[model samples]
Target chain A: MKRLVVMALVGLGLALGIAAADTPTTIRRDGVVLTIPQEKRAEVIGDRLRCLVCQNETVENSQAGLAKQFRGIIRRRVVKGETNQQIIDFMVHRYGIFVLLKPPLIPLTWLLWFSPAIALALGLLVLLLARRRRQQGPPPLSPDEHDRLKELLS
Target chain B: MATMLTRRLMFGLPLVAVAAGGVASYALLERMGRGTYNPQAFNNPLVGHKVPDFSLPGHDGHAGFDQAAIMAQKRPLLVNFFASWCVPCVEEAPYLDAIAKSGLDIWGIAYQDKAAALDLYLAKNGDPYRRLASDAEGRVAINWGVYGVPESFLIAPGGEVRWHTAGPLFPEIIEDQLKPALQRLT
Candidate 1:
């Protein structure tokens, strides 16, 4: 039993060690070194762009083959010394603003960005008005009603 | 009077809240039904842009594909990306053939397909393409922003992408969309 426990512990430790070593710190493809600040520019671009096929996921997180190809395109642009904006423009030109993970805050999207805050503000206003009305306590009972209350108590 | 006002407000506030909520929910449902963020509805950004430069190996006994040569012809062209395995490509092949017969220049980029498979596909579907190129690695298709097979782009005389569709080309699409665009191009 002692030997078995030792072997199990050794196996667990080795598995964890391997997993840690395998954690990717940088992206690579087919032995090409995608390093930054040069390659990091591409990484930033990838994170900002959405995968056309995956819909919900950014190109960086998507496992779709199209996403991988998009990343390759970004890397190539980065290697060619394209500026971040130029690279983004190229992608937007090819795939439209929808390809951007965060749609730009244009007139069309203003409501999307502000509606939550607007709703919260409206709720708070309603709550404050309701609380104020409650705090005022029902308008003090009229004098006649007070006399009637005294008479009933007697 | 104050009590009456307070009572009116109490009832009015809830009534207004419920009405507003109903209106808001209805609007939201309508928007959702319309697919506000639908990727399919998004316009192809390349529509107004020039077709990306590309060169690929030609299949079916055609000469090698060249972008400059195609643009030099100064005629409207249809560039279709397809693969042997894509079902929609098979469905749309006859329509493409019909359009080709109608004197429209249609070219095919066999996306990530082997030459043998492409030859077989063309043989089976009655080759509609004036020239077919093999995009074995799919690099050229990527340049054209093709994420799916059976996507077709209509290039204007100046080599600008004027319109695009992302699915099987049915007769209605050919008659309505492609025909109108072709008419405009001419």
Candidate 2:
């Protein structure tokens, strides 16, 4: 009887979960369904974008009102049928490149983005050079071992 | 031999487990942090979108209300989501009252608080909200993406949310940001 109750509960839980998952999400405007899942894509893009007010925070993570406002703006544009590039352009114009958490691939920001890889390579090169130098140096020989070897050779 | 093997296992086992656990935790945190804001979460700005359906009791309880109708008013509606306990809401009360007096169609939703307390609050602070709705259970707040109290949304004539403000709507943001959206809609 206990097993049957647990099974029934599990089944009920699954049904509720499925029902909640099946909730319709459609963006409709002026009686016409936008049909395109632009909001989903906009969220993905916004999350990648940074919040300028809190420089370290991405639009997704920061609860700063500005981030929320920007997310709303992005959503509005997407619903208005703007492309991703156009939305990005709008943000860049308004907030400047500082709004993007992931710095864009530009001449000025190339160093900011690629400095970590360069530093890593330099560190590895230094380690390799030090290791080679140590390897090329004469091996340490204990006094007793050296004396024994010298005596045997004589 | 068994003792030596046991000693090695004792040291190696914990090290492996710790390393595995550390790596797993790091990966999980990275994955979690990766879900930063994306545009998709907010694709529909209230232009022509069906207003988010929410029914809540009024401050009087005698007159219940729906958000869609208030939002679909001929004049643009300013919906402020506030809680009696929210400090920011208290701070912004004067500004809101002023804005409403200026003939802006301002409405308030008392988010997740008692209607009685809200009425008392308005009596004390000055009623800025022309019509107040009671969201005692926070259902309406969730549908509107309200994380905190004192958030505001400006709804256009078509019952779409035109502008959203997460915190206290300062004079500048209202003047610069919100005014533009309202003008465009009108």
Candidate 3:
């Protein structure tokens, strides 16, 4: 009886697995229906843009109406064979530098670009100060204080 | 005495830094609460650039104006991106009427709204736009780099985007901001 049950379960699993394997993996996600699936070519550029409405999510990941429209724009552009840089530049031309998820290196962004290095230098400075303090040992006691300390110890 | 001074300096410096940070945070939060400081607001790059070419279909009974229409205007035109679904746009409706009364041509773009709902919204609030267009897909809004609804762009007679505001237009904004700006440009 146990062997019969085990065989039935294995048969069911195999049937389900075969069905799953036969089904197509391609499909749209989150938004309006399009000819191409949501996770396709357009996402090459879409992945870089932030959805302004939802703030945290990328345009590809966001379900907001504006994000959907943005996706449509990107999909059409991608279909027209535009380069990723060209598409990104088009967005930048309209939305300004803030639209980029990864900010570009410009004169205004020098501080941002070098923040990690600045932080590392600050960390090193602190470590150096701490090491010097450790090396310096405790401050030398005054003669009167040393005498008082000896008396207390005795 | 020297050791005591150095010890005091070590502790006092961090305490001073913390206190300064707290005070700065308080001031910034106060400004935010008073609506004077907004971190989300960024400068529109389109300002001082010519208006991008776009032609949207006319919605309702109003005529849709394009880049050519704006170039032909002899006066400064306010291109307002609004939608019925946006709450701020409702607040801005009356102020738009006031601006129209003051003799500035106002062009309206309905961003991602249904015609039925938009008609109802305008009927209840007011419609002072000289021409109205529908941006059903929000393509044109993206082209204009509009971040949100109730955004206004003041286009100079020569077709440059002179000024832009990303929020509702209040009476004070029109009286103090737009009028002075128009006066300066014209």
lDDT string for model 3 (B106-180, tens) is 999999889999999989999998999999878889999997898999999979988888888876566666778
Worst 10 residues of 2 chain A by lDDT: A27-36
Cα interface RMSD of each candidate: 1.3, 10.8, 1.1
CA RMSD, predictions in order: 7.1, 16.8, 4.4
lDDT of 2 by residue, A1-154 (tens): 9999999999999999999898667765323344447757777778878775465787767777656666776777777888888988766643456566667899988898899999999999999987997889876889999999999999
Better of 1 and 2 by TM-score: 1
Residue lDDT tens for model 2, B1-186: 976997999899999999999998887777445432222223223334556677877778435469567755888888888888888788888888878887887878888787678777878888876777788766566466455677788787767777776677667667777789888877
Q: Pick the candidate with the highest lDDT.
A: 3
State TM-scores per candidate.
0.69, 0.44, 0.79
How do the residues A23-135 of candidate 1 rate in per-residue lDDT, one tens digit apiece? 77666762346654666677788999999787889998899888888888788878788888999988887777888988899998999999999999999999999899899
Error of 2 at B62 (Å): 7.3
Which prediction has more favorable lDDT, 1 or 3? 3
- Measured by C-alpha RMSD in angstroms, how accurate is candidate 3? 4.4
- Which has the greatest TM-score? 3
TM-scores of the candidates, chain A only: 0.67, 0.59, 0.66
